[model samples]
Target: MPSSHLRAAFVLLLLLLSGCEQEAQAPLDQQLYIWQRQWRPAHAEALADSRADFSTLRVLAAQAHPGAGWSRIQVDRELLAADGRPLVAVVRLDGQLPDLDLQRTRADILALVDHWRVQGIVMQGLEIDHDCASARLLGYRDFLRDLRRALPADLRLSITALPAWLDSPVLADLLRQVDASVLQVHAVSAPENGLFDPARAQAWAKRWNDASDRPFLLALPAYGIALVNGRVESESPLAIAGPRRELQADPQQLAELLANLRRDRPEHLTGVIWFRLPLPGDRRAWRLSTLQAVARGEPLHADIRPDIQQSGPLHEFALANLGNLDGPLPERIELPARSCDAADALAGYRLERAADRLVFTRLNEGRLAAGQQRALGWARCEHLDQGGSRVYP
Candidate 1:
């Protein structure tokens, strides 16, 4: 072809590529991780509330430790089956495990699959949540390969990948064995840096997309943690008592990241799988309404209302959050009441009683989850009205 014609052809090709890059992608698929070790009565309600926004349920089935034998959580098969969503049984191998007991692990997973089948809950996939060191990627890859071969051909296999593996040379080989990978971008490091850095997470996603050939999901944080005396406290039954600093995943930041990812989605980047499903009584996790709204890439706001309940002379002061976003606890609550008897604040606040008004100053910042009410203080006043009650954020 002539020089002019060839140049025109090259420009046309560039235009086509640019158009493809700018084309809007479909909304990413969202999944939920039911990571509770023990099933609860609240799980039913949580599932019902999050049904619309999420498409898949990744239930934690079994966990294996180094010396301690593995334990299993008995999920309500009937409840899960009735929900009618695709279920993925997740088996977690503790990173501290010295070696992978390939045969035993496979046997246990097959047993759980059989158990669920008998209970009429068909599992669509199996995900291995192992945060192995980058050096062990080869061994982990071999384990996944063996397990994949042992399982039924129809049952999909996946792994929960770590950001640490980005530097490993074998990441591609490891990803090749699984049908998909869930890149955990939250709580990957020490708690001092905070959980879920939006900029770092987005950069990691871009790098992971370039590295993996299979479809992958980002495991984002929808919860917070308490660091007490350098010990991290998550959603566990054990309570560590000390002065604790709270680190939470900001909803607005996460929403903005999701919006950006949606606008310029990476190749093979499927969607996000939130860290854990939030129950109504879960203090560390965000509210179900908040999680759902965040998943939908919607704007967020916290509605903190001052709630004053009275019975005769005894009046109770509380703050109720009626919005869809969980946020920092209010710094102060001011109430206009003339009391003759007494007034006291709750554990998180200190009371300063003035002649005309009372102030409940926050001692420490805590999370007031959406759709929840927190008691601040109580007062035995002759007459207390809600007119001048105000909550400061």
Candidate 2:
């Protein structure tokens, strides 16, 4: 697309966005995506708080295709805090709209809602996250209208909307059917393209904020998709390999995006919600501190610490980085080795006879970012026991 066309489209979006900052701002919250058949809380200290409005729970995905089965998300009662925060039950619809049995899907959702309602859980809202194709916008709109009418009047009805829906003729009709909608502007990307396009996201937020008097929330990704650069198959340094790991969200990026959103947010903007809440050890997740930094729009620096433990006949160590910035996995570290330390005491460290310090040179090239930690090399320990402390100067 030409720059001029992009600019023109942006201007058009500005014209499309409705009402000035209106009343009734919604509280910001994080999503809890439970793909696990069962779940347990890993970090209660970080997760249990008023900061979260509601934990959007995925009740299940209704597979309305010819011979499909239900994929449910069941959580253990002990896993969550009953601190009065509601659960926004979300029913995801799978398969193509053309192939889907909308009636069956609607019936499945109602069953789920009633199931929850009878349980007496504190649930004030029910949302659907469906990426219905653009051509199926009308069908999606119709399905929502039916679903809204069928649902109890008290429960808030919302849908996770795709950017494609914004330009569709059915956008207004779709809005009229639901109590609210969330514009998910963050899409997976090539590293160069990034997980989010702030300009594009801001434009869409404005567009939706203006298009609907109904409540609107601009959803941003609090996670990252790691796209590794360079490949063995392609010699080019810039060649990106398809191999990827789910990169945890960077606190810096989140802070930056929140800052930008504040500037571009329209009058009708309710609040922002993260893609999902992250649990400890989740490969594709943000550190709890990272999420906190994002919520606060602040930069956090990294602090590195080393812990040593006795392993078999040798000593083992772990390096931890707790700061926000990636740094200080220093180029050279000196371990105060005891004279009783074996000659081969620290295998990876270069020993200085006169200095008596275990010198870590090559390992210093390592960079440890905040909220991450890893194993550090260890070696023979003579008379010393495990959990021994050595000072680093």
Candidate 3:
């Protein structure tokens, strides 16, 4: 063939390739993880809201290697029947064994899959949550390869990954065997430091994307952990991930992250999954509205107010936040009561008595969010100066 003809053919091919474009994906979808033992009311409500693309449930028991032998976690059959919604099964294994019992492990995993299949639960995919150490990634890879081969060809397999794994060559080798992963960028705790660092998470996401070609979903922390003062307690290490800190994600911060991830989203990037969908009683975790607001990248403003209503000798007091943001108990709140005589305290409230006023330093494990009105204790005051009360954030 002539050189000119060859060049013309190559040019035509290039033009055809350029003309065909990858379809644009919709604004990244949202996924929710239900990691609790009992199905909380929040799960039902969130699903009813139709917010999440799919809800992943933890089915299999946690995996471990105790006494240098393989151990399997008992499956949580709480979610026995699928609610006819798109459901995914999660198998969580948290153990450090010098050597894995690959054959037995594979069998156990396959059995778990079969159990779910036998039941009415229709799974769209399987997600394995294992925090394997960096040194053991090769073995992990082998396990994954065997697991993939064992699973049905139709069921996609995914796993939870650490940000540090992004740089490891074994991660590249491992992801080849799985369908997708959830990059959890929360709970990297340090003393006197925040649990979820947005900047670090964003950087890690970028690196993870560049490190591999696998489709991945970003796992952001929607819950907060309390930091135990390890320094004072010599027995514990510095900054342990707590005894339940009400430190949850702020919607504004979450909104920022959602927008950032969407902007930096690669073609293989799947969607965003909250570390959890919390129950209504979780004062430290985000509510469904906050999650929705974050997904929409909207700013959350709060206007919390304390009101007192009087009916003769009896008084009705309420602490409420009329704004969108979920406001927790501020550092302190002061009431007009000057000692117990002028304004006798009621029994229902947990308020402290200061030098001249009744102060409130905290709530009874509750947050001041929109639509959440707490009925504060009533005092016997007919003409109390409302101006004497104040609140500080």
Candidate 4:
């Protein structure tokens, strides 16, 4: 083809691509926000501070369900303190509603709402994260819809959602009926168990944002690493074991993650909720410095530190052997650390044979503040014929 004709065709193709991109983007009028679980105790305090700059907040309620805790609602009258100020109240809906009276439950939630209103309190919203197959999902949706219809028109509603459900054909229908003040997309996938992928998380967010006009919030993990027999096991909260490693996330990686969210689906990008508040004994997770950066919507550019700490000879040897485990052991060993900072502040230590396996415990005095230290424990394992050891607790 002639040069002029080829150039004209290229220009036309570029224009067509640009038009398609514009059409695919969601409208800018949509609002964005975050839904924090009650697990983060400082949630209300955090919101009260400058960190609460987001457009909305979704509070998880407490409750018990059938079979196991599917998701139930608990109403607290003290949601607003006696002085008439907002107090962070959470109602858990983990298990199925007990065989209790339905009327009582409804009345309870209404009473809690009334109490909050009288104190001039503004609720964030509600959060529920059960499997889609559970009857709890349907019941919860109906309950929310009914509650929304009955409550003041200004009140907001929100819920926790898994990626799998976001992709379901029924999700659009289900969401349409609920009074969704915000939809929090939780990335609690068991990736090692082949249940979730991080990419799927991004896709799920885009899918929901594409399907509905409701605002969306993304929940990021705030736990530490779990090592066994020399291999990094999993990042799931349930699988975590051993002393928490101080893994500082690189600012750059975080920036990339946030950038991907913005590029793939900007409209749904309401805000982010760091999975947890500050906890003690979690050395191998993102630090407050990193979280503050995320809260600011600034670009992240730091590297994630490995979970194991290397201070002295014994500790270094113990860490090396722990990372090279071959099989499971009989008894689980516990190496206790006083606090998160205490674990980080260690200068050096060494590991030696403790019966069948080796053990190295850091002896430090410094400790994290009261609300910081959750707990810590470690296990010991025996080596296999191939000269490798394994430990699981």
Candidate 5:
């Protein structure tokens, strides 16, 4: 038998080897898409994941603003051809309808659509949103009619219905012209912030299901919301600085939410599409681990805080900034075991304040965003403030 010291050294070596193997086996969070400008790196890494199944992977090429025209757009012909066929492209017609001359925009959009069609790509849908007014509705309807005439029979058309538009009597008639419709239940407009009500989202989805024969895709916000010094704005490279606090739901919570949504209304549900894939080197508020977990059929856990006054079936949570602004500031925070609830578990990070410097613990070191909300999977903070160190559970 080996001596005690020798046995101990052998055990240590074995543990170290095991750790190295785990590090090697850990999945690289490299999923990418061009929607958020993270196509190349993700493609490179995904090609390396031999265990990953890409059969169900659907590529979407979305054009959010057609009024700006398609001149500035760079279409990647190589990426567009996965196995030598065109990918599904969703063209978004956003902004005030008045700013859009439907006839001209339609012509522009149709030109691009035809170009892609000839390349053998599937133009899955034309996503549009308009205010609920008699003239606007009629004008939009007319545009759809012309667009439909222009599209090949196999091409699909879809529209986004604001909550108010869904309430309108014309919704049923309007949906008849399209193949699919997406209900943008969550409101992101200024003055009305973080208005994501899961119950309300479900209700709106149900209404669409009962009213229209068209299939629908429910758009959910993959990132959480935070008030950057009490200001809520759209996230972009040039927009307002990063979020003041991160408020993302955990992956398990997201899984539960999806599972619940599937259980409550499976017929209306098609599939979940995370808003804009995370950009390469983006350390902001996105849970890549959670996304991977969901994709791989793993259980996800979330830290949710409940709203007492809400009577809806869905649960809600909020993440807030805990440190003071005037002083040196608490550079880290540790959330104790009972800090979260069943619905809104702490799944991500909130960039609550804009600081010149910020540091993260082992799990979050390379993942935390300096000026944005970041969703957490298995990470925490250390050496916060001038006080004690805090660890996020």
Candidate 6:
């Protein structure tokens, strides 16, 4: 009717549409990377446990190195399909190689995809996990173009991007070749600097979002690694020998970061891909329960305490983790005892006897998975106050 009334109605309509668009935006998708070289029987349990929280599994299917040539992981098909989630097979190429044998590489990946399809595993995408240097990005782009052309029309293509490539001018061209990119923000640099830094990772995600037009995911660390005499051990059993340091990606730190990302996410940032899937006995990785809590943005805590089983004057000491998060064993534990006859510590700890107390000092850093226990030592005393024991970080 009136021009003033028409203007007021138009402004209200615009505001309503904007609110609707914001409400329609979905929460960030969560994915997991199964980087374990071998698939064990425990993987079935892991997959079943993780099926609810994680939407997809990006599995390491095969790898090719300069001198090593090619190697493939024998993935358990039943375990892969048990959860009925989306799957993405990843082919790793050694970044040190001067040039790639494009023909063989292409053939191996296609054959793998074909075999999986025949086995009834529907692959959502094929990812190229190559940590190529910024200078070699041009060559990498060419390889991705070749591989993308050979892949099936329905299959999506993606690449594992490194934050180190942010400085390269050709980064955009590489992103153009893939449907998506996973920016790995953990363990890309030296181990001495630590496995992950939340602030630095957020900054990198922002920069990557600005550079790439396609949707991208951030690969965050969900595990710890041991540095032994300048060597990094990821999947191997950590040896106590030589100078060693344990570096873990804390769940609380990651949870905080995820909350910030949720509050103010980048435009092209689609989701996050947690580094390796956690298994029951994998000492280096986080427990599935704890990881799930982190994905849901729940608070993290570890309730590690000294456990004592007594039989008369004999007392067996152990550390028990009762909380949801797996964490490092405490540096020291002190217990009050009287008239102690004998005592000794376990392999990773040393026992110190005082007049009124016995202390167990850690000799090397170790992790106690949630709901797990490790025997620390034993003590024989006339009267041991097990309830009075204390653990120190």
lDDT of each: 0.87, 0.62, 0.68, 0.44, 0.49, 0.89
TM-scores, all models, native as reference: 0.85, 0.73, 0.74, 0.51, 0.59, 0.84
Q: Clashing residue pairs in candidate 6, if any?
A: none
Candidate 1 residue lDDT tens string, 1-393: 999999999999999988876565556899999998888888888899889899999999988988777888889887998899999999988998887777888898888778877878888999999989988889888988888888889999989989999999999988899999999999998789888899999999999999978999999999989888888888774465678787889889999999989877888898899988988677788888888888887779889878888888898888888889876788888888886389999899999988778899999967777888888888998856579877788
lDDT tens digits by residue: candidate 6, 46-129: 888888899999999899888888888888887777778889999998888767777877898889899889988889999889
At residue 118, candidate 6 shows an lDDT of 90
How many clashes show up per model? 0, 8, 1, 48, 30, 0
Per-residue error for 134 in candidate 3, Å, reads: 1.2
User: Model 4, poorest ten-residue lDDT window?
Assistant: 320-329
* Alpha carbon deviation, residue 110, candidate 2 (Å): 0.5
The lDDT ranking, best first, is 6, 1, 3, 2, 5, 4
Candidate 2 vs candidate 3, TM-score winner: 3
| Worst 10 contiguous positions by lDDT, candidate 5 | 320-329
Please tell me which predicted candidate would have the highest TM-score against the true structure.
1
What residue runs in model 6 are displaced by over 4 Å at the alpha carbon? 1-25, 237-241, 310-315, 326-367, 378-393
Pairs that clash in candidate 1: none
TM-score of 6: 0.84
Better of 1 and 2 by lDDT: 1
Instruction: For model 6, give the 10-residue run with minimal summed lDDT.
Output: 235-244
Candidate 2: regions farther than 4 A off: 1-37, 41-46, 49-68, 77-81, 95-98, 188-192, 226-249, 308-316, 324-331, 336-340, 343-354, 362-369, 379-393
